[model samples]
Target: MVRQETDVTLRRCTECRGYAYGGGPACAVCRDLVDGLVEGAWAVFLRQWDTVAGGDQERALAEMVAAEPDRHDWRIVDAAFDRLVCPDCGGRLARGPVGCPACDLAHGFRYAAIETDRPGVPPGNEHAIRVNVSVVRRPQVTSESEVLVRRLLLPLLLAGFLPTTEAAQRMSALMKKSPPGRRAQLVEQAVEGLAEEFSRTRRAARAAASSPTSPDTPAATRHRSARGRPR
Candidate 1:
């Protein structure tokens, strides 16, 4: 499940002037680093899972399941972001790009101003890279249970409901809970529920985006009536 924080307040980072979660530094750089490590680890873990058998395979899987939450812990990245600084200008990078010329050149001048609820690159290049790497590194699925989990989780994963590692972790948990006799039916019901939720979220987002702005009040109007008689 996606994690949630309560009663959070955003504050501008001292260096970048962009809002950070709980008023901490912008976490883009830290998020990038952590995501890279997690994706690389997943690639290795999944590949190993494909190669091993019996007790060895079970042990590896157990290790992965146990480590999954820590692998995606925000505290780790948040702490790292607090300490990290731009190498070129020695400025904090927690909200986004600092005024370092090199950093601006690398990330774009407007990087800090790009408002987003999620961390990392605004264009999703980081996510794309991770997905590509996972595809290239992980072996094709051979187990029926693995295949079922992937089918159940792929849509949500692609839709950004969760990260790849979390999806894999959830897949393992779900497979453990499902019995072969009713797995197909249970999976179908879960998929339908997820699809409905995704659709509702999409509709709400679209409605918000398309909602009309408030009408201009006369006091705020800048244009004046034409002078004299209409020409």
Candidate 2:
């Protein structure tokens, strides 16, 4: 007796309506966002591990993992809207058109359609902890070192080591001055400097956290006191 073969249907992503590969339920973009979120969260966790009090570490880790999805979504939205402008009024698309009603309506429609799919972690501490633990245990390499250096750049900038304009200027100058062969070395050294600065900022933060708080401490400072060791 001959057996009939059955055709299997691939799942389509709800957001993009594309075939979902790798046995995943979502399209590549959505699936990759989940990976990025996990990796980003792990990077943040490693950097800020020393900032959390020993007793509160578990809770802090969970909260940090939970926050990654929203952060990822907002980053996507911000990038999508960046420098987008109204054609008629030439106003920023994010702010909407000032005088052009047609542009304003179009901007509203486009803004409403902007993708902000927040890929999330699996429920429960076990999954997050297990995945991150595996991440930490993975073997390191030169490329990973460079990636870590690159990852620290934004955090360093946000922590205010140097103005963004100056940093960009210096980077441009370095690229112009260095030969192609030496450029990678020089760039790596520069990023390492930024990483060191970030480390110093984290150290200061840890010191502040350990010190007794004053009633007169500014609310802003107190707020930042809660936020790292850079690797």
Candidate 3:
């Protein structure tokens, strides 16, 4: 079953700004920030998905999974054949589960008798739902420069380049590490260079797509032949 990843109220690591489920453990980004792993309480936990499994798209696919639901008709049909005896002669009960085939006698209907069991909780804690933890792996962030690159990811995403109020916190960290002028220069340099490369790549792709291929039709051959003839 495709279900939404456990994405409710996630907390952020103060040092790296990476997300985490609780306050106890240092998240992947901030290995030095905290000490102990936080024990979680019993709650409804959605299965965690890896990148290939489509991180958050599981929720959307869940709707597609249950698109067709099962339905059963409530009406019932019954017939008796074991007790089907000849109404006129009162002799043959040859019919098994249907009507008397030879006599054409109406034997009436037979229904399954249903008795409801008294509802009570089953004995055993084994039947109870088990509590499980959704382990969120840490982001494999290495350096501050990498973090800066990550910070610029949102603006660069649509440009087909390097793949946000939360962005303010990250920006604050970057600004603290470098002088204002240097920080601005660094960001401008990175973003502008990436933009130029992305534009060049996009233009090349468009050119390739739009370029006409060699025509294989007889008409193309004739045209080629015509062109080959000197004026």
Candidate 4:
């Protein structure tokens, strides 16, 4: 069995307006922000993903990693096998210990061993009507492609060209809804969506870096260090 990284929360750093977890201070990128600027969102924490081993997605990532571990610069990326989302906003969702009340909102049914009371049956018959119900989460019911586009593609586009498990979900969703002849169209759309964001982020930094007059490069222009701070 492969060991896994200690789980961490996913919080949005106020300074950088980027996601950060693995607590301490606001990540390096946003350290300049005042303390407590880092805000945590359960939805983000739950839906956000990271690379892991021995879970369902491990086999798939392992195959790719073994085939070309060197092809990618990073040792790991998000490899999520499961997907969940917020029912209200369709924003990336996080999971938490669910109480009876909360469970009703998140799941269409409740996981419970229920005893049935029959109107016509005598009281003694109630014992025979016990049942177990497996409640599933309320589905978004949107096309998989739409989920992929919003959860994965949108973030990459806005924040730059980073890829994560959310992107994979988006792509998988697209594969399901795409028409037979137009499948490539969905793929290209995903790429284009990512590219658009990458372009903007790169351009902002480029312009700042190239300018000779600026006394200090803007925070957004600098590259993030391993700890998420600007170098």
Give the alpha-carbon lDDT of every model.
0.40, 0.39, 0.30, 0.35
lDDT digits (tens) for residues 100-124 of candidate 3: 3443322121112111111221221
What is candidate 2's local distance difference test score? 0.39
Q: Candidate 4 on 135-221: residue-level lDDT in tens?
A: 011113434343323332322322323355686577777788789688756675666666666567667866876775444767676
Rank the candidate models, highest lDDT first: 1, 2, 4, 3
- In terms of lDDT, model 3 sits at 0.30
Which residue pairs of candidate 1 clash?
25-94, 25-95, 26-94, 26-95
**Lowest summed lDDT window (length 10), candidate 2:** 1-10
Best by lDDT: 1
Off by over 4 Å in 3: 1-147, 163-181, 214-226, 229-231
How high is each candidate's TM-score?
0.31, 0.31, 0.26, 0.26
Off by over 4 Å in 4: 1-104, 107-140, 154-184, 193-197, 214-231
Residue 68 Cα positional deviation in candidate 3, in Å, after optimal superposition: 22
lDDT digits (tens) for residues 39-158 of candidate 2: 454444445555442335544544443334233322222222333444555654333434466444543433232122122211222222222222222213124333322332322322
